[model samples]
Target: MTPDHEVLVIGAGFSGIGAALGLRRAGIDDFVILEERDDVGGSWYANTYPGVAVDISAFSYSFAAEPFASWSRVFPPGEELKAYADHCIDAYALRPHLRFNSRVKRASYSESAHVWTVVLGDGTALTARFVICATGWLTKPKTPAIAGLDTFKGDLVHTAQWDRSLDLDGKRVGVIGTGASAVQIVPEIAERTERLHVYQRTPTWLLPKPDFAVPESVRRLFRRVPATQRTIRLLTDVVTELSFVIAMVHYRRFPFLAKAGEAASKLYLRRQVKGDRTLMRKLTPSYRVGCKRPSLSKGYWRTFTRDHVELVTEPIEEITPSGIRTADGEEQDLDVLILATGFHVLDNLPPFPMRGQGGRDLKEFWKTERFQTYEGTSIKGYPNLWFIVGPYSFTGGSWFGMIDYQVTHALRVIGEARRRRATEAVVRPEKHDRSFRRNLRRMRNTVFLDPSCRGTHSYYLDEHGDAPAVRPASTYEAAWRARHFDLDDYSYER
Candidate 1:
């Protein structure tokens, strides 16, 4: 790939590839995508743990622009989803523009030259007129700090970086952190392992996942009539958006619906646990269901029914060479250990050093107060730089929906910059503050910031104990804001 391009997309995942195509469609061809890994699928390629699948329906998970009517399941597995990412690259001919194994080290913009100088991990330099930070939110894995963790002699693994080559058959395995990954992985490994232990820090509300195979007849209809697929996706999109109300925004107002969801979750847990009251008590969550990101799974609950599987609720004190030790001084022997602890999404700082106007470091700017971005894409003093999945941009729908908004908005800004021959288009600080303040107002009364959740562990809350990950608004409003590019809100420097 060329070291210089008019546009530089900093990832080759769904968001990065989508941004590249979005730029291509805007008739801006001089661009390239830099992927840290050799493969294209960012999260999909990285997360290959057993039973890993999309929580959102496959129809909704897919890009509205690119429709693949032949999804195998309601929630496509990691392998299938990664293949879709592969399909997008091939269909859009983006492979030629991809630079694999190129991890970004830092980015510094020159106001006089009006160009961003991107420095690679190996000290390679590249210049681009515009930058799309599509580096995904959940890319950095977070492992817990357990005493004696390094002394563990048994096989160790992480869900994010699963070693598929390891054989777990007849092995005594212990899985840590009962979050999204643990739920999915436990079910897959239980039957294979001679004995399984699930360490739970905080229980999650697992609603029944509506998963089913696509019948041949339905597939034929989707293929014969492509619009039918669009119609189905549209309907699913509406259903997903409504969840923002029933589950996210106004759930407290509609307490019955929330209660209904919690009721369903309790019933599922009870039914699976049967007469095991102790297990049922351990599985039930005390905090509000919406406080944590709700998980969906039909298999996870039933997996505990296996006599060989045990759910350990005692807090882990340390990791022994033989196994994990609990606060009660009980140590379980394990032949293998897997850490399902999630990513460091709320690190509150850019992964790499970023310098903006007048050589101001982005990290230093946020350190004194907090991390902030305008419209979750543009930052004050950072001209011609955009983040597709930036802070406070997630709109409680499929990530495809969020990326669609941010990418289109970014390209529009670039188009405007080119049209005016403007050297830099930097967002005004007031505008950035205004948008951040709006999100702050929306944060009130949300389940994440609910006073009852003071002790709960959630990645949604940032370092300052504030929930600013998602914009509290409807999908329609988010789309309108995304498309309504206000040139007046930015300062154009020539």
Candidate 2:
């Protein structure tokens, strides 16, 4: 039973608490971390549903090593971002190097003891001369395979595994896939369901959450005004980088900002579903406003202007025993189906089990095509292995500024693996496979990789249409290229 550490960190969230506070400010206190779940708010402790907030903005989604300044709101739910990741694990004492429920399953990578063994899930093995996965990319939960979904039988849950003791008051729910956790659980189960339905397949581009609240004298003037909340998070990161350069280099002079965001989403869908024009053209979304990931809500359009909601864009075609069967043959009974269908962000490291170098297998190098790494945290053959918010590292803005720019390029690759007395480091396989195929062919010429754009298959591409998992820059140029860490793009191993 010999298990130690110098870094192991699997997933205490927020990129394993910024890779254990960047290896405890790089002094490297024999790390640990783990956390299958028992705390430390990873994915805000498995998403406790019901309008689980945070659409970025809590002083640019915190952590420059804790500067929340008491954010009451401006998009801050999920139990106040799981009490601000439990106040950054008690202001960085980090619970004696966490461990929580401990899961890990399988990690492997020895190449003659450069180390990383791992194991866990009751077998317990551990050993780490570096491993920092920070397992995120929306902590699992994808559900949806449909077809009698376990014989309907009612209560099915999924918005990232949320199931808070069931009971949606009058029940009758159903709510499947509208994305962004079904636009925050279909306006919070259309206010205690009794008839919700809400199916829909495509259609999202929401926007207009201008959220509020933060007063306690603006959280004591953003903690006694020191660069006043980093100059209002750098002027909301320069107006969200000039609105992603007006949706990628001035899309035809912003056709009146996409016709005023589609006439304010058709005037908030005719003030929330009055006379339901076929559920307002099935929540109209033919796509455009930044292609996808655009939801923000003032009660998700007044919970589809409830009268016990309805929405249903059809096309389910299964799940019988008493609900959800629409491929036109309609059915809809329900008692509670939920799903909200999201996570599995292009399979970013599902259930551990990596196995890099020669044995290859990062799920067969992402099914031999899509998932690349390079800047999304080094991969070529995964050496000391980092991956804070890995794989193209999604960023429309503020994923805590891309997990503090991948914890400052994984604390400068653990200070270049303690100045070259390194055990392993990799990431130089032809300069990380030609910088991940030149950033997936420069984001396949933008417009959300326009396959003639109409949108829907979320997780931003990877059934081999190849977008290689997000990050088309502009989050302050990916936190200024993850704050400078580029030993000529890696390759060490002494």
What does candidate 2's lDDT look like per residue over 27-51, in tens digits?
7888889998898878888888877
Q: lDDT tens digits, residues 233-255, model 1?
A: 98888877765444676555566
How far off is residue 102 in model 2, in Å? 10
lDDT of candidate 1 at residue 313, scale 0 to 100? 90
TM per prediction: 0.96, 0.33
**Candidate 2: stretches off by over 4 Å:** 1-102, 105-119, 140-155, 159-173, 176-179, 183-263, 266-293, 296-333, 339-387, 390-408, 411-415, 422-473, 479-494
Deviation in Å, model 2, residue 298 alpha carbon: 19
